[model samples]
Target: MIAEICFTADWLERKRTELGGVDPALLERALHAFALLGHLAESDLEFVFKGGTSLLLHVPVIRRLSIDIDILCAAPAEVLDRSTDGKNRCGQSRPACQVASD
Candidate 1:
């Protein structure tokens, strides 16, 4: 099951200790990246998560935190438009996902 990202002081403290005094802002950015990733996963889009952030999270040898997410969307850009359900958790219209040009 995919977990939702919730911000709390206790979460911050735990991360700070776990990551050896990494900046709180960077951690927050990471949280946002995770949230976005979770949203993407819940959608119908097909993607492969990769890059520095992926390594930092999954590879124990990488001790540094990355502030961004890098994903390769396997589906066509038009599929992204059809997949979004409009309203998000915040009741705002969800923005269309953009696939980076190679």
Candidate 2:
């Protein structure tokens, strides 16, 4: 069964008006992003949710809609030190950083 998260077009329109002209399409995408987060929670990967999206979700007063998803891995540094095809500045391989830059 597909769980609902108030992703109706009507709700998007209403929210767009409430936020003083946020795009309904963007609002819908944001709802989909939250749905993805729900799925992520059920997975084995551990992470700490953060950034503007987190603030908008948790803090009612923050009316600005942020489409970005920022998260911190719960894994230890050693666990994160996997070899990668890319390298960051200072010529050190950072998988997470490389992925973000891509």
Candidate 3:
């Protein structure tokens, strides 16, 4: 599962890089999103790092222009459901999710 998340993140980063010169705001937003994802994965999905986001956390320079953030999860379905369903572990609906889904 960890491998799966890492692969997914890596793929997304590659996609971002392919669309070269993405704006700083957009990059920051993406990184923030990844941080949220990491939190969710850690809290609800019980994910542990397998040297995934460590790269981003340790290297400040890499954080600036990182194509994407990498994360490892043991439960992909839980992550997907939480992400799609817009509910955190506490069962709170994320307004952003509702708006985006709508």
Best by lDDT: 1
lDDT for predicted candidate 2 compared with the true structure: 0.56
TM-scores for candidates 1 onward, in order: 0.70, 0.59, 0.40
Best by TM-score: 1
lDDT of each: 0.65, 0.56, 0.47
> Distance (Å) between predicted and true CA of 30, model 1?
0.7
Task: Give per-residue lDDT, candidate 2, residue 54.
Answer: 86
Query: In what order do the candidates fall by TM-score, top score first?
Result: 1, 2, 3
* Candidate 1 per-residue C-alpha lDDT over 16-43 given as tens digits, one digit per residue, 9 for 90 to 100: 7788888888777777666666677777
Clashing pairs in 2: none
- Give the winner by TM-score: 1 or 2: 1
Q: Compose the digit string of candidate 2's lDDT tens values, residues 14-102.
A: 77888788878777767665655554454455778887788876675746776556768856554334312233221231112322421
C-alpha RMSD in Å of predicted model 1 compared with the true structure: 3.7
Poorest stretch of ten by lDDT in candidate 1: 89-98
